[model samples]
Target: MKFLQIAAIAAALSALTFGCQKKAEKKASYPPTPATLVKAEGKSVRKYIDTLGTISSLHSVNIVPQVSGQIVKINFEQGQFVKEGDVLAEIDPRPYAAAVMQAEGNLRQAEAQLKIDALDVERNRKLAKDNYVDKQTFDSLLAKVEVDKGVVETCKAALETARINLDWCKIKSPISGKVGLYNINSGNVVAAGTSVITTIEQLDRLYVDFVVPSQRLYDVKRFMEANGGKAAVDVSYIEDDLGHRKTVAEVDIILNKIRYESGTAVLRGRLDNKDGLFWPNQPVKVRVNLEEIKGAVLIPNMCIQIGPKEPFVYIAAPYKDGVYVISQRDVGEGQLFDGGMRAVSGVKDGEMVVKSVSSLRLQAGPFVYAATPEGLIMGADSKPILDPAKMREFMSNATAIADELRAKFAKEAAEAAAKKQAPVEALKAAEKAAAGE
Candidate 1:
């Protein structure tokens, strides 16, 4: 019986110890953690889809000689811009000029023969009417006149062809564009319709070709239809600043067919490059604004804390006792916005979120100290009113106060030391007087 009683006492002691430990742990409290905080605000957000594009010329021509001849004069420099019908090069026109003269002479001879035949036909008709010529002979004379008239018409066509060939000796630009390197220089014999003189590319108005995912085709079409059947896009070189947004022409056919390999479709945009900033086959960036979201709740990207389940942020609020506390609030993250911010759904507008904390350790209802742009504003509905000038003013005033305090403390320490030393010296002098006595 005594052994059983001792066992019961031991069990009681063990339970008591466990209870005390639990109480001590429960009573422990963490100090207020210092955290950098940002405010969630509502604003107009523009959604944009970005992709790489290539600049291409709408018109690219490989200039070829229309007539075979030796180049007598190279009228244009390599890489010079020329307008349509501008003379680019001059082939040896002397031969073509001589050919034109010869054709003209042939035409004149045919016309003179036709005139003589007509006069003979008139005389033959009179002879036949007067019975001075047989009917068969008159018919033969009329046939000769008709044949001569046919010869004259053929000669006129030949003369026109000769003139056209002569004009082609002066090679002209087929389109207004910048010319590439000369393939055939002066004194080089070019084959008609075969040898390439040079290449011309129209750069004033350029085409930019890009690809968009097949998923976005519907949105692109819908947006375009709502906005005058034209999807406004912008194209800029990779090195250009994104501040200025330029407009791009809508493609007549938007992604005519989907690419099976990449699940993308080709989109072509036209840009007017009056400044000659764009070039053919040049790599560029394209931006297409799809839609706008009004009253978007945005927060800094760094504020979101990812967990095993979902992403969340620390909501810093204050208790009725004037002590600020932080609670973890789960958030549904949306697409990223400008300025490294993200659109979030859980947090309301004007809500304070912990952007950065001194320690990564976080818990529910933990005490927190909030730092903000607006002179250390604290609590739940508080937002950091960002004013650079105000922040500078606050820093200057704080620095001045610190310097004054430091100087006052130094002076007080010096006075205290002097007082202590005088008492010690006076005591030593009194002891010396007693020794003398």
Candidate 2:
């Protein structure tokens, strides 16, 4: 009976060992986690200083008349584009024309009188030589001739002034620009240099005025010195219906003095406004490119993860059978650009970065399959499974897979706890047995 019992005990122990080995093999067969990755690119990244800006015309003029008169006719439509010397409005020219005529008549009279006085002086000079005329009378005639010549010059000046005033009656544009509404319309008299006739803003080129902290002035100067004495700028604005628009502008001027109250220096950039997309006094965003970092590692903004100490990114290395091993890397972040890209260091060019992971507790050395941002698992060819039927099948079983993984993790945790308690439990049992003895 003892031999039979020993054989049965040996068989039971062997079966239990086999069952434990099989369970271990099954647990190891779980599929790799899915991860989405983006390839880091090598490119030039520009460092910029961002600030708010205002769009202003390079030339804005408040049109005021040089001569006062009644406005007879408005020659330009409201908001019309006018060239320099284009007739904008016509004042009543009747009075001005009459003044010119009167001045001409007076000038003609002065010339006639001067001619008579000169003839008299010539005839008297001959008489004085022959003693046919008195010496005092001849001298007086010559004096009259000189006085008449002075009167002619004065009348000529008056005529020129009258002509100029007449020309001013027709108000004309002094610059090529768009005209604003007429302030003083037809039949209304406007004071010279006092009443604003209209406004004109030159829209061919615009100025983007912005301010930067005074501390950044040195940086701007450095960039300018390196880049042909001018730094590049980007001006952007958003419209109500249309989306954002941006254009490259040239930095033209920096104010000589900084604002004491704001501790900022004013800067201006020139933008081409031929498209008429920008307007005076319009607010916009300005980005001043202070410097450029060549051959910088560029990655998507989403790839960066904030850690307790610093920012980090997950790098993926190709392992076996289309699986990747993930590793964390601390990185120094640089400038952020449009289109959700950022400049970073400590990442090699052309390396794959894990953008996201399926499991929350994913750590280093975990095998992961490449997946699309849409969660579709990639095939052995490293392409996403785009077939609708296959995608549906994978999605349908995703919940089951997740549940299985959760159960497996829970079971492993419980086994580890049990292992830790096993030694303590045995020690307690031995102590209890000793006490009983």
Poorly placed runs, candidate 2 (over 4 Å): 1-32, 45-52, 112-149, 212-216, 231-236, 240-248, 259-264, 285-292, 363-367, 385-437
Q: Root-mean-square deviation of each candidate, in angstroms? A: 19.9, 10.5
- Per residue, candidate 2 scores C-alpha lDDT tens digits across 1-437 of 22223323433344445567855554322455678888999998778898889999999999888888888888888999999999888878888899999999999999999999999887778789999998998889989999999999999999999999999988888899999997888889888899898999999999999999999899998888888889888788845344367787899688999999999999998999888888999988888987778998889999998988989987887755456656678999987887888999999999999888854435211446679878778876668888999766655554344334334444554566579899999999999999995
Tell me how many clashing residue pairs each candidate has.
Answer: 0, 0
lDDT of 1 by residue, 180-279 (tens): 9979889999999999999999999988888888998888888878877777777766765753535465554576799999999888877788887778
Model 2 steric clash pairs: none
TM-scores for all candidates: the values are 0.72, 0.71
- The best candidate in terms of lDDT: 2
Best by TM-score: 1
Q: Indicate the residue-level lDDT of 36 in model 1.
A: 80
On a 0 to 1 TM-score scale, where does candidate 2 land against the true structure? 0.71
